[model samples]
Target chain A: MKLQHYIGGIEGLEPSSFEKKVFVQPWEERIFGIHVAMMGLSSHLEAVKSVPTKFNSFWTWGHLRQGAEGMNPFDYFKYRYYEKWLGGISGFFVESGYVTEEELSTKTEAYLVNLEAPLPSGGEPAIDAQIIEYLRVGDTPACDVEAQPKFKVGDTVTVRNPPPVDHCKLPGYLRTKKGVVDQVYEGTYNYYFPTGDGVGDPMPIYNVVFDSHDIWENITEPNTKIYVQIFEGYLEDPE
Target chain B: MTENVDRETYSAARVRALESLLIEKGIITGETVDKVIDFFEKDMGPFNGARIVAKAWVDPEFKERLLADTPSAIAELSFPRGMAGAEGENMAAVANTPEVHNLIVCTMCSCYPWPVLGLPPYWFKDPTFRARAIREPRKVLKEFGLDIDESKEVKVWDTSAQIRWFVLPERPDGTEGWTEEQLAAIVTPESMQGAAKVAVPA
Candidate 1:
C-alpha cells in the first residue's frame, strides 16, 4: 500500500489552500515546458519521425507518474509538485544518457554564478514544429478497436483490490468498494504500458458511481456522491 | 559558499541548466520550451473554458450538446486549433445546477483538461485537496468558501482513468441580457472546478 495511492480519504489533513496560479514560481514554467517537449517528441509517437532528433526513448505521463511512485513515500510528500518534476525529469535525461551528471552540474554551477547567462541557440525548426503538432493532434489513448463492454449501465460491480505496484490509476479508497456502472465509455483505451496490476491493454472503461456513505460511511458529507472513471481491469463482477 | 541557497534559486538554476543542456544536445531546440509555453499562454487556458461556459449560458441547444457530449460541443466554437489536444483528448463536463453541484479531482495525480482549463491551479494539484475532496467535498468546498446546502447533491468526479473531467459552472443571475463575451468575463477557473461560484461583480 503505497501512501501515494491512498491520498483519497486520508485522515487528519489540514484544510488545503485554494491557490489558483498554475505555476507558483517562474521556474516551474520551464520544467513544465520541458516535460511537454519530451512527451511530444517521445519515440512512441509517429510525430517524432517528422523531426530529426536524438531523443528516442518512449516517455509519457505513465513514465512520469512511475518515477514519482518510485520515490520514497516521505520524499514524495516533502517535494512541492514541480520540484518532483524537476528531479524526476533531470534524472531521466541523465539515466537515458541524453546528458551527463557532470555536465549538468557544471552548467548549473555556471547559472548559479551568472543567472542572466544566455542559452545556446538553434536546432531544427522541425523539432518545435513536431512538438507543436503534438499539442494540436495529441496522442489519444482511444484505440480503433471496439470496446466490447462486459458491464452495462446499472450493473453492480466491485473494484478489485489488486496487489500493489509502483504506480496505479486505481484510487486506493475505491478498491474493494462496490458501485454501479453508470456508463461504458465509447471505445477501448490503452495505457502507455501495462500497469502489471491488470490495466494497460486496450479495454473498455466505465464510469462508476459510489454513494458517499458507502465509501466513508457516516463520516462523509450529506447528499455527497463520488464518481470515478475506472479501467475494466481494476473492476470485477463482484464474486 | 552556496550550501544554503534558497529552494527557488537552486531549482530555477537547475532547470535552466537542464534546458540549456537539452538544447546543446540534439534533443530539443532552444525554441522548443518557449513554443510549448506560448501555446498554453495564447491558445490554451481558462479563457477558452470561460468562453465555452458563457456560450452555454446563452444558447440552450449548445448547452444541451455540451452536457451530452463535451468534445463535440467544444468543436462547434471557433477557438484554438487544439480544443481536443494534449490532456484534453477525452474531456467530459458535468454541469452544476440548483439541485446538484460537481467538483473534479485526480486522487492519483493531477490529470486535468489542459486545452480547456489549461494547467491546473496550484490548489487543485495539492495532495490535501485530492485527499479530502473525494471523502468530504462539501467540507473541502466550504474551506474554499463555497457552501452547498444539504438539500443539494454534491458530485465529486475523480479523474482516475482515461477521462479528464471539468465542471460546467452554472451561470449566476442578474445578467440576463448580457452578451456571451460579458458572461465569459465573469466565469472564473475556480467556478469551473466547482470550488467556487461565478459571482456577478458588485
Candidate 2:
C-alpha cells in the first residue's frame, strides 16, 4: 500500500504559539534547564505548522545520521518528541496518542546511550533493544544456527498466542494461528532488527503454512490455505 | 496515457527542476547529458524484464537460469538496476507452465520487485487489490479475464513483505520460432503477474 495511505488523515495536536516559544529556546538551554529543573515554562503561544511536513522533514535529518554510534536516530528523535513535549513546561507531548512512555525510554536508552537499556517493561524493551542492536551490527553471523527448524513438512503446530504490541510486523489479523507445514523452505532470511528500520542485515529464515481457516478462523472452505514464508526472526519454537 | 494538458513549458520546467536536483546531489556522474537524453529516448523499465522472460521462453537453458537466480539472469539484460548489489530478498522467477501457472499478489502492502520490475501498476497499489488479492485471488484473476481450468493448478504467491515476486508466464503458441522481439511484444505486465495470458494477434 502507498505510504500515504498508512499516514492518511491522522492529525495530531496543532503546534500552539506556546510550543513555538518553548522550541525557540536554544536546544542546549532547554536540555540543561529540563535536566536540572524538570519544569516547562512555555505553554501559551500558538502557531500553524503542518505537523506531517515537519515529521517528514525531521525524518530526513534522522536518516542522515543513520547508525551513528549504533543509534536509530529516527526512533530516538520520535520518542524525544514525546519526552520533550511531555516533559516540556508548556505541556506534555504524551497527550498526543499511541506513543507510550516505555517506548520512549526504551528507544532513547538503546540508541542514545548505546547500552542495553535494562528493560523494565520486560519483553518490549528487550525486543526493541535486540532489534536495534541487530541493525547496528549489520551482516552478522547467525547467533543460533542450531536453534534451527525442528519441525518439517507435514508437521502440525499451533501459532503461539502472543499479545499485541504497537509497531510490530505481525499483522493483528494473524495471531495465535495454527497451520500445517506445507513446505519447509530453508536458508530464508529474516529482516527484523532492533532499530525498526528496513535498513538492516538479513538473517536466516523459514516459511510456515497456515490453512485459510486458521488464519481467517471463519472461512467457509476448510481446504483453502495460505502459505507464508517468513524469516526465522518472526517465529518461535513450536509448542 | 495521453497528456491531458498542453502546458509544455510547465511540464518541461518540472522535469528540469528534478534533473537539476538529481545532478546537484551527485546521483549520476560522468556524461549526465547522455543519461537525460537516454531517459526519454528509451523506455527503461520492467518491460526489459518482460523481454528477458520472452527470451527464456524460446531458450530452455535461459529458462533454467531464470528459475535458479532471476537477479543474475535478468541482470544480463541490463535493466535500470538498483544499488543493492546482492539480491536483497527472495527474487524468484516462477514460470507459468501450460498445466500450472503462477500469479503474484501482496495481501498486506504492495511489495514489488522494483529492481527487476519498475513502478507497479496503479491497481497493485490500490487498497482493493491489497484487501482482495489474498481473499479472492481466483475471483480477481477472473475479473482480469484469466479463467483457469479446474484441471490446472493456479498458485497465487502472496508477497506481502520484503520478498519480491515476479511471474514468468507461459509463452503463447502460434508464433512458432518467433524472435525474442516478437515474443516480447506479446508479454504484458499483466501477463507477468498472471492476471492475463499472452496471445498472438488474431
The regions of model 1 sitting more than 4 angstroms off are none
* Interface RMSD per candidate (angstroms): 0.9, 20.1
Task: lDDT for model 2, please.
Answer: 0.45
Residue lDDT tens for model 1, B45-69: 9999999999999998999999899
Task: Please give, for residues B88-175, the per-residue lDDT of candidate 2 as tens digits.
Answer: 2346778888777667766543456544454356556444554554545555566666777646665666663445678888777688
TM-score of the first chain of model 2: 0.34
Candidate 1 on A89-138: residue-level lDDT in tens? 99999998989999999888899888889988999889899899999898
lDDT of 2 by residue, A59-164 (tens): 1111212212122324333432313222332222223322344544444434333222221211122222221222222221234333346577777655443442
Q: Model 2 reaches what TM-score against the true structure?
A: 0.55
Per-prediction TM-score to the true structure, in the order listed: 0.98, 0.55
Model 1 CA lDDT for position B164: 82
For each prediction in turn, the share of the native Cα contacts (below 8 Å between chains A and B) that it retains comes to 0.89, 0.00
- TM-score (0 to 1) for chain B of model 1: 0.97
Instruction: Determine which window of 10 residues in candidate 1 chain A has minimal summed lDDT.
Output: A230-239
